[model samples]
Target: MCTYESSSCQTGETVVIGENNPVGSGNKGKRFCPQLVGTSESFFIPVNIPSSFSLVARNIPTDQTKIRSFDCILRINEAEAGVQSTFFNESYILCESKEYMYADDLLQNNVSVSVQWNGQHYIDDPTDTYVTLYKCSVNGGSCSRCLSPEATPSFLNCGWCGTECNVIESDVCQSNRFVNQNETNLCSAPAITDVRLSHNYFF
Candidate 1:
């Protein structure tokens, strides 16, 4: 069993969402529990792509007694772009662990987070673990999964729509002598004024 966030939660905010008795085997939770270490990763929609944001945890054991590898997958509109693992195949952990991933090199706005550990067992139940999630937003920009009617569409490779101007950089847009109906690039495609100015020379 694993815990995942349904929506964005701020970093450093803690919530207790699970509980069970350790002594009672009938329906009692595991006698031993590992606490969740606090660490968080954040992501933003690309400054030019179209996508949705999500945080996910997979392969996590609900029992808490057993130690095994777990994976965290970050998705953009459910599209896979990045993945990270915890308690790798070679290692195991008796307690919940924390893992972190920084911004950069994201694909489809996908990110994976994982952890590695050495495992052993101990008995003492009545404990809880929490998964904390945070979202990264630009100083004055908002994130979106699609472009507005006035905004230009992003390159196919982009993951989320962000605060930067973009053009379909194909040969058609580059040629001053040719006007291609299929190609269109705009200087004010982004929602932010500064971003539009930053790319002003390109237009």
Candidate 2:
């Protein structure tokens, strides 16, 4: 005697069903049903770093029937960095960390992000859950290293100028010295240009 609507069943959407026989139908006979969705993909980003940054996860499925809290764990170089709990009602989650992570600390650029629902279910893929860390400014590093394909992944937008690596629009490097990731040849060029002297003198 239970009737359920199939067309109304949608992800994150709920519908109620009850018996229509009418002999002894009570409130307890009604069932609350919630549509659960599976997480297809999830990814996070370091919105800001070295001071205060928000770890944001996108496209994460949510179950409203479960607890409203979830845990987000961050791992750097295969070591656990920290974990923070976040509250969300939708498919998006964010956790903010004030810990300072220097460029030297993330030189390896190996980071992993994962999330758990009420300490019960993990919602992200295990095999392809690595996040690429981007740091263009490192101590004692040359411009070539900053603009190299190996050093600067396609996702990072940075350029080299003089002795510093900055965002492409930062204008830190002069016209002739500015080299971006697109200029592959400039990565191999010498950082300093040589000037031939006509005469030699003692300082």
Candidate 3:
């Protein structure tokens, strides 16, 4: 059995001696080297608004000197968060999102954390950790703002009917609704009140 304090170990060594008491070299056997092991705790610190928060990782293992740095990756739901900042540290890492991440960015109000060595190297900690964030309502925005392409977190899924926001597949916004999911020119058509009919007609 190996303990936490044990760095290395060897097992199953055999030694054979000749009849004249001549000692022969013994087999070194299999040796086990020390492995990186640690636990990570993460949390979200609200920086500016409910949609903006800084990711903080703590209590990471820093016993290995060969590990140059740790890469803290932020995952929204199950996909990679398209933040511009790259967080790096020796024991822990702190990263702030460049773009705003709204409540719609998360599936369950939680963001996943994946800590790696350097860039692509994996660590001994296989378990994934998550940090919970404040859930802000995505509804109640103007039709133009809801359907605008410049909106942060492109997955906002805002509907252009009476300023409502929801998943693209939701039936909340029914008539005169334009979802901001995929289709383009959704808000190009003028509203019913914007059309003015001319009285004079010539054939």
Candidate 4:
């Protein structure tokens, strides 16, 4: 459901890997339903995070019918980060989150994210993707040499391990920092409202 445009049939082209369906049980008689042929109108799922608890939607492909392939990604502010996916049916789920979606206390005082009055400083993990995330709002300068794509992964801040910043601000690191680590404020602090998810993309 990620990019529904009737693109290709690569997902269906395969030999019987296991004995789930009937025809696939016999070799040379492998069941092949790889190509999902159709025009897909992506659904708009909304995920508004209310204070108290965070919500995660696992194995989202199960909820969708006629699903050929599906994937879900995470984002900070609006910058896109790396995404995970599943082909046909695998052990992994279609959609998943890190952790800590909401809390009544998070709605009132300083949240898991560092925050001051300056408006959501460079503190990391505004969305609380994991238990411990670092926020570092720095200009995209020699970042690959300074950070880890997994620790602070983003198109704007992603690279091989130990590769510092190599691009400009708009093309790379901007004003926000989202490190999936222990609470380490690389920049300053920023007040956060409830962490939010777009239901239009979820349920």
- Runs off by more than 4 Å, candidate 2: 1-68, 83-108, 119-128, 138-140, 166-179, 182-203
lDDT of 4: 0.29
Candidate 1's displacement at residue 181, Å, is 38
Q: Candidate 3: where are CA atoms >4 Å away? A: 1-42, 45-68, 82-91, 100-108, 124-127, 139-203
Residue-level lDDT of model 4, residues 1-203, one tens digit each, is 22222234246432333344344343231122222221222221111311111223222223234443343333433433322333224222333333212222221112222211122112122244322122222322433323444434443332221222322222232344433223223422445868987768753
- How big is the positional error of residue 33 in model 3, measured in Å on the Cα after superposition? 11
Q: Tell me which of candidates 3 and 4 scores higher on lDDT.
A: 3
Candidate scoring better on TM-score of 1 and 2:
2
Order of quality (TM-score): 2, 3, 1, 4
Q: What would the TM-score be for candidate 3 when compared with the true structure?
A: 0.33
lDDT of each: 0.30, 0.50, 0.43, 0.29
TM of each candidate vs. truth: 0.21, 0.43, 0.33, 0.19
lDDT for each residue of candidate 1 in 54-147, tens digit (9 for 90 to 100): 2332222444344443333333344423332423222132222333333443322333322322222221212222222222222113223223
lDDT of 2 by residue, 103-122 (tens): 45443364666666666656
Stronger candidate by lDDT (2 vs 3): 2
lDDT of 1 at 121: 24
Measured with C-alpha atoms, the lDDT of residue 53 in candidate 2 is 26
RMSD of each: 16.7, 11.4, 14.4, 20.6
